[model samples]
Target: MLKKAILLIVLLNGLSPIWGQKYELKSIIFEGNNEISTSRLKGVTLSKESPMWFLQFLNSFSGLGAEAIYFDSSKILFDLAALEEYYRNYGYFEARFSYRYELDTSNFNANLIYTIIEGERSRFRSTFFYGLEGIPDQTYASLIQDYFNASNDWYNQATLEQNINNTINILLNSGYLNARFDSTIIFRDTSANSADLNIYISKGNRITVDTVIINKKGEGASLVNEELLRKITGIEQGSYYNQEEVKRSQIRLFRTGLFNSVIIIPEQNEVSANNVNLNLDGNIGYMHELSPEIIVNNQQSAFNIGLGANFIKKNFFGEARKLTLSTSFGIQDIFNVDFDNLIKRFSFRDTTLLGYVDARATIEQPFLFGKPIFGTWENYATIRKQKDYNITYYGSKITFEFELPKYTFVNFLSTYYNIEQTKEVYRTNNDSLASKLVSTIGVDLGKSTT
Candidate 1:
């Protein structure tokens, strides 16, 4: 069945045999490269997911996943350049790399061998900051301290770029909309392999927002209420031009599910002095998503088949609300593999009696009572046959989730369940109460946000 499944997918996927372009990678060997691992580089290289050794051996004799990975010399040059750029980003400025490939035309296979020589690395000597006369002395000092703390002995172009951006953001968030940085990298004692960084801070005039405009991509899409947008963004006229606040507003609004994409831009005022307004275009509206589920079991004891469907109504109420209707049915051990007559407890039932059915409806609301809290309510019913008894269950659950600091969430759930069983499916006379009422409460920590 595994072979048949693979063959079926391949035939339908339109895989054709093309000569001279089909060869699997034998091995990727690297020498004199020490800073980075081969596995990391291979992950970036063009290769399909690695199969087990047995699969490779099988492919050597037979054609299994034969078209998965084929060698193309055209991509090797780009990959080599990518490897060099990767090393340069890691402070290996003087790294030299070259590659050689050995291919066997008879067997249609190849081996890649790479040689590399990494030279001495450049380190930081001293950092000098200037032109910060406009910024408050205390603020400038704090920014410098933060840069030093974040660097912590690492001297690379990437780190310096990040440090500079962070410093600029600090000033921009502090209401300095026109702030700019004059920076340079001076190699200090190249023989000693040390570099000096000089960043001249120009904290331009502090500014304030003069206006706020809310515009939608479509003429009138009722995905989000205008009042709600104003409140959630927390941006208004006469407010400071705070970049952090703008970013937070973006996150908060995007979280609402009202927009598929969001971008907030600040436009400087041409006539008004030290004043700017914001322009944001949101791609808004609702979408209907259909998801399918499939499960297969070939094990003797658990010869089962399950099929399910989920119809999700995204933004059901013109907000970040979801209403989902789903159903699932499973055929469990229909063939009665374990034909145990002595111990019927462990025996499998007939095909009709071995099945289970489930149905459910759920609604999720991300913002409850105008707060950043998630709430969900679910109602469900299920029926299953075990041995000769028919068991039925009905339940409802209420869940509330809250977002916390550092990408963490806490969830609280309360459930009520009612279950009953009967020996005869058609008559209620043989029915017995399995459970009158079962209530449960659970608290989950570190839940996901999406």
Candidate 2:
């Protein structure tokens, strides 16, 4: 029994050596057949010794069955082909791999050849639009053409969708309220190796104005009186609303200077036949203005002051216009001294003091790009008394001014003056007429920070 057990142990030990003596990798031959460099492949594998070759060798058996352990030249070629395919999907179509296996008495060495061929870049061929109706054909054509020309180089799903959204906004501002577009996009590949895109849009409806209403508010009363409101409404109760008319009316109301805020809302009147109702609300506030000035000269220093208040009303004659009525008061002081020399000798000296008051009325129209053009006529009479003389001056003047791009200017002006003087025992009267045409051109040097 002892001899039989010893023989069994020896048999089991003899089988262990055969099981442990499986296939061991001698060397790895990397056939680099790719646009990528052979150095890059080496960097990826990074296995210089034979013992480290097993892990990388296993990767060569991915699609093959697990039972196949020994890798031949054909198997290495298959693995390199797989790697080349991986690079092709990433826009590197010209990538290729070639291998050289050098066998020695006891080991093997691998030399890889990677050939890369970069091809022409691909781009989008055409962009198309469809299903857009109820929108102006000219506008649609211009927008799409412009966007295509601007974004020809950039091809992506996100950019295509953004272009559609921008087109929708343009329609909205042009008074198209019911506009929509589908996100579905179709790409057509042609024989020329280019892609064309087709987009579908749905333009729902076009809206128009039918009618408008005006509402007024003030601190203690209505901004526009009931009678004024009645006159300002150019349309009847059932007239079709006009956007141009509404805009004109808003400008007129703003020119009044009485309203601090104005809002125009277009409300749809379902009961009326295709008519839109507009609500205009205005908030009225007081009009306040001030003019103060100071002057210094060799003879005398003087100060002049003025204050004004006014009320504004719009559409006085149902023409969507504004009319303003204003009143103002001003005061001034002038101190003067006179010196005389006769034959190099002092002869006489005189000093005087004067005071005056002025009142006027004016009519004006609002203007764009400059100050408003106004027609003003005034009448003034002043009383003045000096150390040796007493006088009264009266006159009228008409002036017109316009604002220009480069400078503010007085286009035309005319003035008439009459002076009546009295000295102790003598009285004299003089009348004069004068006119002036003034204008100026200059460059504005100020820069805008906003």
Q: For residues 1-450, could you state the per-residue lDDT of candidate 2 as single tens digits?
A: 999999999998986754444333345544423344554554443332233444556656674323323324445555566555545333333445555544332323333233334343234557677767556777687558645764435334455566777777655544454457766554533234344667776655455555456577776134346444433433345443444445545654565554678767777668743456668787766433344433333221445444555544443443223444445443334322222332344222222222333333333333322333323333444443333444444454444333222212432332222222222311232222232332333223332221
lDDT of 1 by residue, 1-450 (tens): 999999998886654443435666667788887878988887765533336567767788788733236567787787778778777666666778888987777676777877888776777667787766676766677577756675436457777787788788878877788888876755555477666777777877778897767787642355466656666676767887988778767886786556778878999888876888887768775566688999677544778888999988766665467789999987777575454542454433343436678999988876677765667888888887655566677778888765454312443332233333222242243544444556677666654444
TM-score of candidate 2 versus the correct structure, residues matched by position: 0.38
Top model number, lDDT: 1
**Top model by TM-score, which number?**
1
For all predicted structures, in order, the TM-scores are 0.53, 0.38
Candidate 2 Cα misplacement greater than 4 A, ranges: 1-127, 136-145, 148-166, 180-202, 219-252, 272-275, 286-362, 366-450
Q: What is the C-alpha RMSD of each candidate to the true structure, in Å?
A: 15.4, 20.1
TM-score of 1: 0.53
Q: Candidate 2: deviation at residue 58, Å?
A: 58
